[model samples]
Target: MLIILILPLLKANHPDFMNMATKAVKRAFLVALIPLLLFLSESTTGFIHKLPWFDIFLTSLDMSYKLDIFPTVFLPVALFVTWNILEYSLWYMAQDPNQQKFIKYLLIFLLTMIILVTSGNLITLFLGWEGVGIMSFLLISWYFSRNDAVVAAMQAVLYNRIGDIGFLMAFCWLISYSGSISLDFALATTAKSTTLPLVGFILAAASKSAQFGLHPWLASAMEGPTPVSALLHSSTMVVAGIYLLIRTQPLLGLNDTALTTCLCLGAISTAFAATAALTQNDIKKIVAYSTSSQLGLMMVAIGLNLPHLAMFHICTHAFFKAMLFMCSGIIIHSLNDEQDIRKMGGLQHHLPLTTTCVSIGSLALMGTPFLAGFYSKDAIIEAMNTSYVNFTALLLTLIAVSFTAVYSLRLMYFTSLKYPRHNVIINFDELSTPVFKTITRLCLGSIFAGWLILHFFLPSNDITHTMPPHIKMTALLITLLAFIIAFDLAKFHWTKEPKNKITSKQFSTNFYPIIIHRSVTTLTMNFSWNLTSHILDLLLLKALMPDLLKITQLPPMLMVRLSQSGLIKLYISALLITLFLAMIPTILL
Candidate 1:
């Protein structure tokens, strides 16, 4: 079935039937995914578990017993399979060749996700993870022919690899500390140990999620194509980190040290990224920064040991964020790829559908009442306030939530409400670019409340064990304040207009960006590292090189003395002690 769908993709560029190729791919996708659909059909009203299909993979590999098939494996795979069917539909309708390539990669990645989600063990999960990473690199560099795309892809891959180091470190630590790295044994050993794994797990999560020091790359990732942004901003991209954290959560400690670190990192990242978003000029970059901030908020929930709420926010935020990015893409496409929201205005008249969808998406982003974001995001704030005794974390999170409103509403106001700060030169070609339409519609769909599945499905009174009234009011009030601010911005935008066109004065536009571009800011920020490295490299290392050579010049005479001393048993006791210590772990295990 999968092969049938892939055939069209392989022949999408064929001369005679390019039109038929997309349909063929769609058919192949449906055929390939039927098994997954059938598997997910089983009802699991009580818990997130099911009979294990991974046993087949295990049996095929000639493995023994202990294959536990349950919901964790099935649910993610089900979601992937479901998303692929949707992607196939969207891709079949997307006419652009570049869009086809994007679709092709997306299909392959979804297949890989299926493998990862259903994997019976860590090995299987890692396999899918690397595939996801590789696909992300490829899709992110979708505009590889462009210089900035190449750079953005590079930054993303490099940053992820840094996180991978922590993953690898934890993997090795597991192997050394415990006999096996399997989840079951690791869980047992984690309880026995002083909880070293928890700290390592955190290092792994922080880097992967683009939290704190790992964050700048996520901001730079906006250089990629827009759909790529939507994917990166939502769904599998950033959420994988949180998923890993949640999965390994059993091993992680809830001690004061662990909680404090999580809270501090989450707060700093939440507040810092919000400030960063405040300065961004590009519409997508602002959203990208928001992604960072939102992810930080998710981390805060996770640190508070509120994985359920984090997961809840993850699902809802994914829908709304993807929606905003796709809408931004449409607006850019409508304006001939002019992404500066400042330059756009009065699009409401020209793009009625987009105006409505983008506004609601922004509303959802701001967590307006009755919207999916309202339920999920406010749930996180409520969880935070309820879980943490320290008021600092909750206070900071509320402040961060306010900023989300500010940036989100600001995004809508600048791009959708006015005639554009700069003149738009491109003609709208909605029929030619249906992929953008698909993504936009998907985003708008979230505003209506489909995303409340998590909140609705979980056992009633599980957390409150009651769904507090404050959740509704908090989200409503926060969203209203944000919307009011946005409305005021729109009113101001309505009253003001740029006098001259962008093309009319080239230097006029280039001058402001040149002065404000992050290059100057970066150099200042890295000044200490630069100064320290200069002295270390030029003065200390270079000067020490000759002195070290002079000391080693007398090695001929010293060699005989050293060899004679080694023969002497003066340090025999020390060597025995060192060997004994090293052998202790092997003996213990």
Candidate 2:
């Protein structure tokens, strides 16, 4: 772990060191990751060696420590994060001129991945947790030369920190309430009590996960690179929030109020993001909001006490959302970084593979039949039918269901569909455009992989056996309705509809709930940002360059004050006399 972490930093700062040192450092980071990979691979293959066909995957599970569940969340994420690190390192080392500018981002990226997946306790989680916040700040400032990038990156960090503070409080509360930060210990304790710390834990989980008010930051995060968006949406920033909820599921039984709040917030965030996404002109932003909204739905799934369904949705969402982000990246690259979907069209012929992958991703997003998203999205809403609380959740999910369709298709249409305009220029001048197609294949593989796992092997877990089929059927029906809505939207002529103009009031009408989330965000910006630095400056009261002149050449009032040294002698005499008097009194006593 130490070497794995160090190599990235060395590579990042390589230029400052000697020439040979740079090569050695770069090689060092790569070599370190290799050992971990070999060990894990050997262990897995050895354990599963005797099992037939597909049972081999299950055979490997026995090797893992029981404190940490294997193949479920941690191991997969760790392997993936390591892959991200190696990819980042290679990209950075290649010094592709264009990529060189963002090389320093490698360290932050890999560190975040390591800290998160290997986190054994809440504190460790926070370490990986906050690493993301810091890395986000750095990457956001990647194009620091741009005023937009700097401000946007700062906004991303500031907003996420507000959520991080909640995580910190929850971590502290966990230690106080449960006597340990271990996920098992805390869950065990939570399974026993109805207490305030449980409430704190819930708020922390909800806020960090982008529940309701904390949701806007995810949309703004599109200001960073598309790869960042893919990772962020898939397994890092956004996932951290949901992971906390899953990790703390044991304590959830202790407080119904906390769970209800999470449920309401999740519902509101989903509806809010979906509505907001519908009005977005920026393709990435539309997808960004959609990711947040989808995450909100997953939160609700967990809140409704359906974690297996939530986990299923999380897996499928990861597939489609990552594909969507990567595809959006391709479209943006093809159009010379033009993110406005309105400015994009006819890219289906230009980037056919990317277009195809995005279409599959979109189908998955809409929960169309036979797709990865279909099975999971259906299960969650269907599972909602089992109880009163769940029934309300089911209703909200259905009403909001079509919003996914509306925005998901709207996103694909503007970017890939043929919308004729008087003067439009589409540029495909970059290699990343084709490289993005490969990413799409990767995404499709993930989506298809899920279907294979579920259809053939049957997704095994603690709860799949007990779940009712009708509930799954109900979810499937809602998903089907959503797909129909997306298809209908796709058939419409959006370009011919008047001005091609989007309005603040109109967009806000759609985005109002999520945007209102911005007010607290605005107030927070003032405190952490505007008012905060102001307060810090007041505290520091440092001398500036201008003050150097003032000190050398005093103002008239200061000259007069300098001349008045008469009080200095008088003060010294008084001190001496007081000391003498005290000494005499002590001597006499």
In model 2, pairs of residues that clash are 209-241, 378-475, 382-471
Q: What would the per-residue lDDT of candidate 1 be over residues 1-589, giving only the tens digit for each residue?
A: 3354456566656653434444554454455344434434643332222233343422322111221222333243234323533442354325556565565666565556555444444555566667777887887777678888888788778778877777777766776666553655666665444446667667767766788777766766787766567766766667777777766655554455666777778877787777667656688888887888888888887777776667667767776777677767777767867877777877877776776777887777767777777776777777665664467766677777777777776776777664556555546754445554555546544765435355333522346556557653664676567667756765775356657556535523233334544676688779978999999988789768876676777787786666566654657866888899999999999
TM-score of each: 0.72, 0.72
Q: After superposition, how far is residue 69 of candidate 2 from its true place, in Å?
A: 2.7
Candidate 2 ranges with C-alpha deviation above 4 Å:
1-9, 13-67, 70-74, 77-104, 419-437, 452-472, 490-493, 499-504, 507-589
Candidate 2, residue 288: the lDDT equals 81
RMSD of 1: 12.1
TM-score of candidate 2 relative to the true fold: 0.72
